[model samples]
Target: MDTCTSFKGYGRVDELEEAAFKRKTRNQKIILSISLVLFLVLIIGVVAGTLVHRKNNNNADEVPAAAINSAEAVKSVCSVTLYPDSCLTSLSASNTTDPEKIFQFSLLVVMNSLEMVSSTFPKKFINRADDPEVKEALKVCETVLHDAVDSLDDCISSIDGNQISISKITDLRTWLSTVITDQETCFDALEEVNAALVTEVRHLMKNSTEFASNSLAIVSKFLKTVEENNIPIHRRLLEAKHGSPSWLTAAHRRILQVGKPKPNVTVANDGSGDVRTINEAVGRIQNKSERIFVIYVKAGEYVENVVLSKYQWNVMIYGDGKAATVISGRRSNGTGYATFVTATFVAMGRGFMARDISFKNDAGPQNNQAVAFRSGSDKSIFYRCSFEAFQDTLYAHSNRQFYRECDVTGTVDFIFGNSASVFQDCKILPRQPLPNQFVTITAQGKTDPNQNTGISIQRCEMSPLDNLTASTFLGRPWKNFSTTVILQTNIGGFLNPLGWLQWQASDPPSTISYGEYANAGPGSNTSRRVQWAGYKPSLTAAEASKFNVESFIQGTSWLNGTNVAFDST
Candidate 1:
């Protein structure tokens, strides 16, 4: 009985020990939960504080603010440089009066460089951008730059000022720099988010030097103009420089000097230091300069084609004489349609002047179409020149031009164009190949009534080259309202009794204005000529003055050195 009681007591002791152990474990678990919760709360507070501090610091970084400020400053500078009429007035108030031209000359350099950058670098960069927004923004910036340049061009063309200061030009330079800088900043803001943006930004930076160099060159030219204007004799001398005894040949030689002439530039046929092929000499000239380049050619047959780029200006090509020196091209209709009309000499450069040079497309009658000279230049002049061809010859494409003392020969409508041109003292030769092959002088003109484009032949001579004779007309209207005039000219017997040809049976007579003023020759019998509604044989002196060289060629500024007589009668 005693042993059984001891066993019960032990069991009770074991149960109480197990219960105490369980209680200790519960207390430990509760303490662990409370400590873990407190640690988590502290971690959350620290993380939130860090985030807020970073946000504040980012906002305080005022580089973005400064960029905006700089942009505004740039805008202000541009307004001062271009917007204020007072600046133009102040510059013109001085004794010198060619600020507008000087500014234009300087700005052309900047524009040309910018064009190169925009065409080359910007295209590559835009295609490589990954972010849509960033790419669009860059495109927008480029567009803005282009638009700004165009606006600047317009402003320069219209601005009437003389002698702009270097400081004022510097302001423009700053504005252009700011435009590039701002674009760079935009790229930077996007770069971290968009890794691809680096290419565009890098391109901008790389090309910025070229842009800056162009700007610097422009500023330098402006300064030079101002300094030149300050010198009284220098300005007058430049304005009043007279033509030399061999002015016609000298002018062309000067034009060829614009390019880097070959080291061994040999005039193959002459003792009078002059080039043979103008193109060979043109290789030596620099782009975008105001200096006049003259190329002289001695009497010889130069079988080559020549092209004058738009960048080349104040260029002149002269020969020993039209009869002696011939620039000839043999490409004809057999040489593809393009080659058929390929000119022996193409004058595309603005302010291009040539004299005493016989430009010939020597492609014979069997060759079909051949162009001797093609000119699409504004303010262009061809004095004492000759254009010889069998088919299509003179391709006067666009702009206002003057050809005085020239001999032009062709079978078809040789002088074809959509430009305002006046041919004075020019010999018009019509070569007849077949009996019915009618000689048409002009084919195209201003289709729009608003456009001022037409051909005015003043004091010209019309003659036949071959024994074969056919009815020749003044011109056939290629486009609507084809305007042509034959004023005080000697019309050859080869001219058809009818003055003009009707391309189609029912041409808009109102559209074309084919007229003649006191034309004298065997073919100038007005009584037997075409009784077309548009033909007017008699004209007053005031009416004929419109076709004069001075008015048509804008010769007041460019003809300063020339002594050519104007066809006033």
Candidate 2:
């Protein structure tokens, strides 16, 4: 009945103890709350300020004395994150009580650091590096670093001041999250080409990565603070009282509400409505403040790429289902494009929502990595969307991203990235593998333990297509400390008994956090699963909850507003 299933008694959980556990948890929370208040008070007043003058206001921007009084508190907060030294150094100058200002100033510190390092890339890397292959990789790294800097600048600018709207804060978090991914991407590229070059690159770029990580940690804190403090914040979320949004009459007065969606623009192929291409419409949209700009694409196969940049937020692109609406391209890693750069449709904006659309790259598996849909959008959502490709289909690049009721089809490392993302009730289809080859569903790239990043698939269905009996596995680690969880999902029997593959045969990633809980189907057996240090057969109920949408991506709080019907439980 079992293929050498590992001993379960080591971490086996007792269900009857759950009642006592709840009582203990409540007692702990009370004790911790009282202790934190006193500890937070001790961290004030270790301060400095870099003031900027305001044209309209009489006063200059300065750190509040109250924040200075709580200096140790700030450091305590930083201590809980990944890079304490980086967080403390970057945010040392601005000691502000306002969470928004803390977020803004923390981002500014990283932005400046990235800018400084990016300026040196050309001379220090591209020209100085003797190896041609190394120089080429540096060029890609330089571009990505510059993009990260741009994303940081966008995050800082989006926060007008301390008291901005919740949507803006979400934007800030989204971009900061993207910056983390951008930094990781550079590292991934270098490591793939020559792992030896990593030490040199890390020496020069590790500070930037640390700073970006700090910014992400700070934003996460701010979001939690706001939620906990019961601060009245106006978040421009589109929630339908009736679950998924239904078509309302044009005469409805709610359409004119402050943050309601604007009139949709149309796109058609044969001389119709507003525009001929997706880019044309995307180019015309001025930042509509918080109002969502909906682009209704007509039923046609539009053969062009689309991008929603950091400056373009709250945009919705929908179409007439996957069969009729298709956006495709043929760019691939083999054709001089990095895997990240080859995505046919890229979303880097905040609050980006798409539904009933199909994004494809027809370059086939022969082209190496050809991405169909790549997203670094924070709080971004895709519902009933289809991502089609052969090798690399969808790059959930970074941030708190979610995909519900979507179809993702590919051959190798298809649904991959370094993001804390959730895929709920989606179809994960693996294509036919070549003779003597096998299929891998995911290639998670989490490198840092501090990152709240992992690929969590809950209630998702994984199946094979065509004559795909070659063999299949759940995933392989794309980097050290990689984490992925498959819970309450149905797996097809086409999968190999071993269940997972390792990128490094001689030195497998012992820190890989691979696990499956309550998964039902023929392939869900853990009998022959790898006996890695980090692989868990069944997570404790508490541990599994941490991987749920509520804990992993905190989707329960914001997913309702995405207009995508998701299982809240």
Query: Alpha carbon lDDT of residue 173, candidate 2?
Result: 61
**Mind giving the per-residue lDDT tens digits that candidate 1 earns over 1-569?**
00010101111124544465455445434433443344334334444554456557866554444333333322222222422232233223222212233335435544555566556555575687665555555564464345335433533543336333322343343233323333333343344235465674566544433333333333333333333344211111111111111112233433433332223233434554545466777775566566666666767888888877656766766766789888888876455434313678876555687767799987786776678887766557787788998777897765567776688888878777656677766788887764557788876555444234578887678888666376678788766677787877888777787778877787546667777787888988877766667666665655554444433332111222223222221
Candidate 2: tens digits of C-alpha lDDT, residues 1-569: 11111111112124533454455445434443543343344233222221122223466455564544445445755765788877877776776654345556777778777998888864576666777656666776886787788777777767655445434445566567667778778877776567476887788777888888877776566456544654322122221111211111112113222232343788898768598999888987777347677888888999987888767877788787888899999988777666767889998776787777899998877788899998887667777789999887989888777776788998888889987787777888999855677788998987765466889887778888676876688988887878999877889888898888887675356777888887888989888888778888777655676676555664223221222233233
lDDT of 2 at 392: 78
Q: After superposition, which runs of candidate 1 have C-alpha atoms over 4 Å from their true positions?
A: 1-266, 269-276, 339-341, 555-569
User: Candidate 1 — worst ten consecutive residues by lDDT sum?
Assistant: 1-10
Q: What is the C-alpha lDDT of each candidate?
A: 0.55, 0.69
- Give the clash count for each candidate: 24, 11
Q: Give all TM-scores, in the order shown.
A: 0.54, 0.74
Best by lDDT: 2
